[model samples]
Target: MRIVRSARAHIARYGEAPSFRELAAAVGLSSIATVSYHLRRLRELGVIVETRGRVSARCPHCGLTP
Candidate 1:
């Protein structure tokens, strides 16, 4: 949930998706791998979509950008 919230806020603030490092920092996570894990979960949950090396939020959902 923290990952999701951070991702959403990051997108809202920057108008773009964040990198793994950025998201990790925002969420107080130490591992990019951990962030990646949450990201995969988000994808499975249909919260975010990754395309062409960039990440974007699904409509009506909070998400992080690449």
Candidate 2:
């Protein structure tokens, strides 16, 4: 999933999670709703998590927080 990969990379490079708009741009997505849809699915699958409006990979080995 590009969104997940991009989110992890963005956090690794910037030391913070990206906003939905930033993520949309990073993954070449034109709609924030699409990002939201994918995020929801990812969350349900335990591939990602959201805390206080920030999104991060669920795997601890990813070494990121949001």
Candidate 3:
């Protein structure tokens, strides 16, 4: 959940998604692969979605891309 939260915050603050390295650093993760794994799981859980090669968290209430 931290990664998703971080990603949403980063998008809000910067108007763009964070890269894997940036997301890892933001979440105190040292491995990009670990971030990748979590993101993959989030995608499967429908907590996040990938569009046009970009990943973003979905609005929990409406399930819309944020």
Candidate 4:
């Protein structure tokens, strides 16, 4: 919950979604495994969604340009 919320907050401020690496770095989490677990949670919760690959792209279904 904390990771997802932190990530969402970061995105809300940055205007673009952060990659798992960026989000993890911002929140001080030390492992990609941990971030991956949390990211799955966020995806399942519908608070975030993954899409076609890019370093900092928002979902086509949601975001400023969508």
Candidate 5:
């Protein structure tokens, strides 16, 4: 998924996660809700971590606890 890939790249480069709005723009998405959907999917797939609306990328092998 581009959303997960883009978020991972942003985290790797900046050492901080991007906001939902920033993520939407980076991936050419127009709606924050769409980004939120992708984020939920990513969490299910163990590719990222989202807690209380804050987000961060996670490695597949070193999966995030929450």
Candidate 6:
């Protein structure tokens, strides 16, 4: 949840978002796969959309929440 919130923050800061590794580092996760795990949860909860490659999301126009 903190990771996703941070990702949202990075996006807001730069009009872009972090890659999995970057998010992991930012949130103190271990690796990209771990990042993927939290990301999957976020996606499942409708907090964010996951796409292939870096910083890909749909409708950041919409609220990120379950």
Query: Over the stretch 1-66, how does candidate 6's per-residue lDDT look in tens digits?
Result: 578677777787767777888888888888788888777776777667765666434435566422
The true-versus-predicted C-alpha distance at residue 63 of model 6, in Å, is 3.6
Quickly count the clashes in candidate 1: 3
- Error (Å) of candidate 5 at residue 59 is 2.3
Clashes of 4: 0
Candidate with maximal lDDT = 2
Ranking by lDDT: 2, 3, 5, 1, 6, 4
Q: State the weakest 10-residue window (summed lDDT) of model 3.
A: 57-66
Better of 2 and 6 by lDDT: 2
Shift in Å, residue 17, candidate 5: 0.8
Model 1, residue 4: what's the lDDT? 67
User: Quick one: RMSD of model 2?
Assistant: 1.9
User: Can you tell me which runs of candidate 2 are displaced by over 4 Å?
Assistant: 60-66
Flag the better candidate by lDDT, 2 or 5. Answer: 2
Comparing 1 with 5 on lDDT, the higher-scoring candidate is 5
Tell how far residue 14 is off in model 2, in angstroms. 0.8
* Best TM-score among the predictions, by candidate number: 2
Model 1: residues with Cα > 4 Å off, grouped in runs: 52-54, 59-66
Q: Please report, in order, the local distance difference test score of every candidate based on alpha carbons.
A: 0.72, 0.84, 0.81, 0.62, 0.77, 0.70
Report the number of clashing residue pairs per model: 3, 0, 0, 0, 0, 0
Extract clashing residue pairs from model 6. none
Query: Higher-lDDT candidate among 3 and 6?
Result: 3
Worst ten-residue run, lDDT, model 6?
Answer: 57-66
Candidate 5 residue lDDT tens string, 1-66: 677677777877877788898899999989989898888887888788786566787767755222
Which lDDT value does model 6 have at 28? 87
Tens-place lDDT digits, model 3, residues 1-66: 798889888888888777888889999999988998999999998788767656676757544455
Model 2 residue 53 distance off true place after TM-score fit, in angstroms: 2.0
